[model samples]
Target: MKDDKLFTAYIKSAEHHFSGWDFSYITDTGRMQSELLPWSYGSMAATLVQNCDAFLDMGTGGGEFLSKLRPFPEVAWATEAYPPNVPIAAKRLEPLGVKVAQVEDDTTLPFDDNQFDVIINRHESYSPKEVRRIIKDGSIFLTQQVGGTDCIQINEALGVPANDEFAHWNLHFAAEELLQNGFKITYSNESYPAQRFYDIGALIYYLKAIPWQLEDFSVEKSLEKLYEIHTQIQSNGYFDVRQDRFVIKAEAI
Candidate 1:
């Protein structure tokens, strides 16, 4: 009882190319939307960047967000663990006097201890100890992370469990880890925002973009559930999911 045409279209949507951390194809088109968070991580980072002597952006995918924070300090560096994003980030950030490094291990970063005055991360993984070691005493580390329960509704609808490894990664656990690693949490906030998909295609594209959301995701495997969600959307006008997000500003002590 599958609608052949619709299934084919959803399958095709999953093939859409996603680069860096950009989701403009769906976000810009208004096909998918996530509600705004209470705090602005960008504004907070920009203020820090204005006064810092040395800055670092960890897990800077394609340097898309960092490039916008102009008027860089004398020493501005970005690191990307994903191989493909390193070149893209370099091409965009180097001309602006930002050096991009390809990093493999978060525990052992490339920089020297007490190197940066400020560090910013957006939805990137980091070792609390490494962050403390790299930043000078009294320096700041600001990060906006995707929490453990992020997009749980999507996984439930698709009949899959969320990634167990990151299931315990929430604001409380992260802040405690930072404190244990010689950081004092100065600011912290956690929120579950609503993300809506107006079409099945947008949902498929999102799943493809974030492979870790549903590790075994494949159009062939999820087609039936995708169709069910598609039908729900047809009836209800949209499919809504929850986004788990938290921001922390910790000072190295």
Candidate 2:
């Protein structure tokens, strides 16, 4: 389950979602509802990141998670591949003392090795080797991934076998990669919580933002399912439509 196709498609869709908003003027005031977003890795970092001096934030989108680490860590630097998101992240984080970098080339990082005591990857599009190269020995690396079941759970109702059954991102994949690269897997866990879409239109908009659901989707038909879900939401106020996620902690050996 390489998930190459899903990644390719999803990146484009995510770009579209980010495109609609101007990051510089983001509404700075949504009280955090629960845990991180659909694919956040904060729950992983929370357990092991205490009292670190320097940190590297990989794939920092909108600077949401990077900003949270400010109080516990003295310095936090972030790298984002999406140029549109970089300035937005910088605008939000720099005000609070976090440094930001725009990663132009995919293969290399601008930092020196052994520079970060803690490294965070919420949803990385790059290779783990690149992540390994950026951190020093004894540093901690934490990631929160869209659970392996995320796609399957969504597509099962549609009677489509998950495109890459084995490809869903999860903590185990990261742990194995880290272990092979000389890191010790320390902790991992899953949180089950649903993010609701009030209407089928909203659900479609949400689906449009992620990959995999782009091709072969019948928007009108999916909207029917959305209406049913919305009806349930109207009665219950929330739906159990959640994406599973795995939080992981590993230490560079």
Candidate 3:
């Protein structure tokens, strides 16, 4: 494609509204794709939900993934820190009998002590102390986190400075933190999977959707680098990057 066409695509992607953790637009358009992890977080969460009496889902973005795991426990609750996702989560989860709470931040949990038998968190920030306080003794805490090195190649490709905010967010560190917080780590695993983007538009959309990836990212600001990547994609069919992910299952002792 020509430079003008590439510029148009980047502009369109930058202007697109990205709400609710959904990435269907890029995937459906065949612009970006990622390989699935070996293990199924959804399956594990479903099994834990089935065995627990009360459950809480942390950072349930629009309740999209949580809603898929049907037949929740008797008392089901979800917390969302993002303001726009609160109502969306409620609308989707209320019918399933799950109460969605809008939380101010990740430091405090609103629920009472021993309120839940199981807590599932996916790519959400949580306070270890709050989790320990809210969950019953011997309760389970399952979390799938995006590791610190996730998609670092995006920054490298754009010639931008790397962000070290999550530099130590790995499975080992997370497990150690849980242990220090009086939890027994039952399971832990980490993976670096490959991701591919077919077009500059998709890359722009992804960066825009996940602003933290490149906090100051903008189409105009990164035009030259984006064009370079566009040329690379045209020659190689896609631009590749590695995604960091980790899973942890801990039990309150």
Candidate 4:
């Protein structure tokens, strides 16, 4: 007999509305726990923008993190590619003197050459040549990217193949790209930190929020595998996965 109550709970979690790159629902409640990386991307971004005249935050989803970086530069601009997030970012950032623009292509940013003194990207895709063009000479381009192997355990558990599109993206690959595109790599780090889900509901919520993890994911389709995971969690108290992350700081030549 199936556990109807638990299944209903999981369904509700999967239906939950998530916005603005915020994972606080599960994180703050301790339902999902992710270990900290060795380096802090926010702190590094703050340091890079200090006393700088102009700054740009690539893929500023809902301006959540960017808005928190107070004491902005004279010209603070942010770009959001996702349509749903564009209005959210503009609403949150514009009032704070940060102009938020909707971007369609990462390769074609709406900015003049050498416009920004500092460019920061957090888990956002970018064209190396575009970054080099937008950033001033000797300026900084800091990015913390999600590695290609991020959270493979989930895919394995769900019997889904991992997304191979960016499977080659790693610290070395990113740094070398920057080196080839008129930038000098200054700092780089990579880590596979532990991530734990205390309940099946939280896992459902996570997969729902991050659609790229399993592009074809749906609760109905993965119900059996999800139930298997739920049983594992029930017996072990949590499901563990490793999060692949890498950071790069490069200076435009």
**Reference-based lDDT, each prediction:** 0.93, 0.63, 0.89, 0.91
**Residue pairs in candidate 1 whose N, alpha carbon or C atoms collide under 3 angstroms:** none
Candidate 3 RMSD to the correct structure: 1.5
The numbered model that scores best in lDDT is: 1
TM-score of 1: 0.97
Collision count for each candidate, in order? 0, 0, 0, 0
Tens-place lDDT per residue, model 2, 1-253, is 1244532332233333434223221122221122344444555565445567888778888787666654756667888877778888989888887888989774688988678888877756556676678788988888776665664545654445665644646666767777888788877777667554433334444555554643466555554454455556557754445566777778888
Model 3 bad stretches (over 4 Å) = 1-3
Expressed as tens digits, the lDDT of each residue in 1-253 for candidate 4 is 1756865676677566889888888998999999989999999998877668999999999899988888897799999998999999999999989999999998999999999989999999999999998899999999999999999999999999999897998999999889999999888899999999998989999998888999889988998898889889889999999999999989999
- Local lDDT at 242 for model 1: 95
Tens digits of per-residue lDDT for model 3, 1-253 = 3547755765577566777878888887777998889778999999998787899999999998999898887899999989999999999999999999999867678899899999999999998988999999998999999999999999998998667899998999899989999899888888998999988888888888888888788887888888889889889999999999999999999
Error of 1 at 94 (Å): 0.6
lDDT of 2 at 24: 21
Candidate 4: pairs in clash: none
lDDT of 2: 0.63
Greater-lDDT candidate between 3 and 4: 4
